[model samples]
Target: MTFSLVARDSGTGAFGIVISSSSPAVASRCAHARAGVGVVASQNVTNPALGTLVLDALAGELDAEAALKAVLAQEKFPDYRQLTVVDANGSTAVHSGPNSLGVHTHLEGEAAVAAGNLLADESVIAELLGGYAGSTAKAFEDRLLDGLRAALAAGGEAGPVHSAGMLVVEDVPWPVTDLRVDHSDDPIGELAALWALWQPQKNDYRVRGVDPTRAPSYGVPGDQ
Candidate 1:
């Protein structure tokens, strides 16, 4: 019911995740990332806590594979979960539980990893990785979104995806980009539109959080 990609941008050292699912608000549960740490996508049976646990391990200076291993080791039902991790060094790791849904698969590539369950075919994972890797010239967030779009074009999940989202973390303690289309007929398109609207203001919002005096006003009411 879900497909996701976790990746690190080699050019900017940013980490990002893009996800879509038949379930509403899928990314709220599946996407996780921390600045200077790593990114995690925990899906399948959808234990949202696994995202936090794996991120915690990554924050503890564990590598991607080691972080995933540490979290799964403590999980009571590891066989029902699917997880992907990409650490700060661009190392990637993935786990597909034995009890994963139909046509489930995962792939790891240079600086990126992709996983999907209830997929139209396993090839979706490969296309996702290729899409991100092939778009090295684009901005980091666009590359991540390209991967999600490519997976959908290559045959995404077994059913129509209703929700889609993207998360990106840079040097700050908070996400620089967090966009979601919680429920929609074309969630990816909606998410992309949101990204377009957010991109120019992303850095401004970060500045607002850290130093409001240096932040640019959006010319909205009361902002002046």
Candidate 2:
């Protein structure tokens, strides 16, 4: 129902995801990210807990493989889940089950993990991973968009992408800037444009030294 990408920026330590899905409000349900912790994409049979729990495990300095093992160790039916996790340290883990639909598969690497079930092909995962990992950029948002675009080009979600969203939580989280498409015929394109609008505003706050990305620092630009 969704084709999404999550990425980490090596330069700024930012994390973000861009996604388009045929399902309603896919971003809210399918994409989860925590800056300096980890990202979890839970699909097919979505498990939101995987997002928070996986990030907790990652922040505890667990390796990707070990963290994933521990998370699944608690699940009653692990094989029913399709999940991908990437730690702040760039370790990755993915699970695509044998019982999943025909094209189901997952690929994990140092900086990225991708998984798709009921997809056009298993190769979609690798394509999404390669796009994000190889995109050497300073901006987390751009890297994430690259991943989404790649997934779309690789035959997205076996259907048209409808909704999109992006999130990156730094030490602070006021301006929030959690861009969401809500719904769109071309969600990726719409999300890219929305991000363009958001960047200048973000920089405006930055240049005036208004620091909104931090949770407690969003005060008048110069008076503080």
Candidate 3:
């Protein structure tokens, strides 16, 4: 019911993940990531714990493959879950539930991982992976979102997608930015619109570069 892509920006060293699901608030449960740490997307019979466990393993000095392997090794029902891991060094790996509706596969590349269950077609995942691999930008967040957007454009999850999210963290206390569109009839469109709200400038004010807590100084020193 969920599809996701996780990748590290080759140029900025930033890591991020983008996700969408037919389930409401899917992101709150399906995605987990830490900047400079690692990224994990656990869904379709999600272990939930795997999300944090994978992050800890990578952050605690384990490689991506090792971290993912350890998680798979201990799963009592690995055949029912799908997961992706991307370590601090940009290494990527993925595993899909063997029982996943007959069309799941992992697509791994330079600094990214794309995987899904109950997809419209395997080509959707391939298209997403290709988008990530071909990205030339410096922001992993953007790349991840672009991958998901591409997948959505190609037709997502087998069914309708209601919730979507983009998550990225830094050394900062919280995620640099965490955006979610819950229960939207058109989640992808909602997500794109949300990104535009955070885009650099509009109305002579900018949401970019300013702290979320800072009030924007819109007009001028002398206003009507």
RMSD vs true structure, all candidates? 1.0, 4.2, 4.0
Question: lDDT per model, in order?
Answer: 0.93, 0.71, 0.80
TM-score on alpha carbons, each prediction = 0.97, 0.81, 0.86
TM-score of 1: 0.97
Tens-place lDDT per residue, model 1, 105-186, is: 9998988899999999999999998988887646788888888999999989998999999999999999999999999999
- Residue 156 lDDT in candidate 2: 70
Clashing pairs in 1: none
Q: Model 2, 65-166: lDDT tens per residue?
A: 788889889877787777777677767777765566556777766566667766776677777878887777557777777877787788877767688887
Best-to-worst order by TM-score is: 1, 3, 2
The numbered model that scores best in TM-score is 1
lDDT of 3 by residue, 1-224 (tens): 77888887767666778888888988888789887888888888777898998998887899999999987898899989899988889898788878866467778878788888788888998889887677675555566667888898887888899999988766554676678998999987788787777544432232334454565655577642
Clashing pairs in 3: 120-158
**Model 3 residue 90 lDDT score:** 88
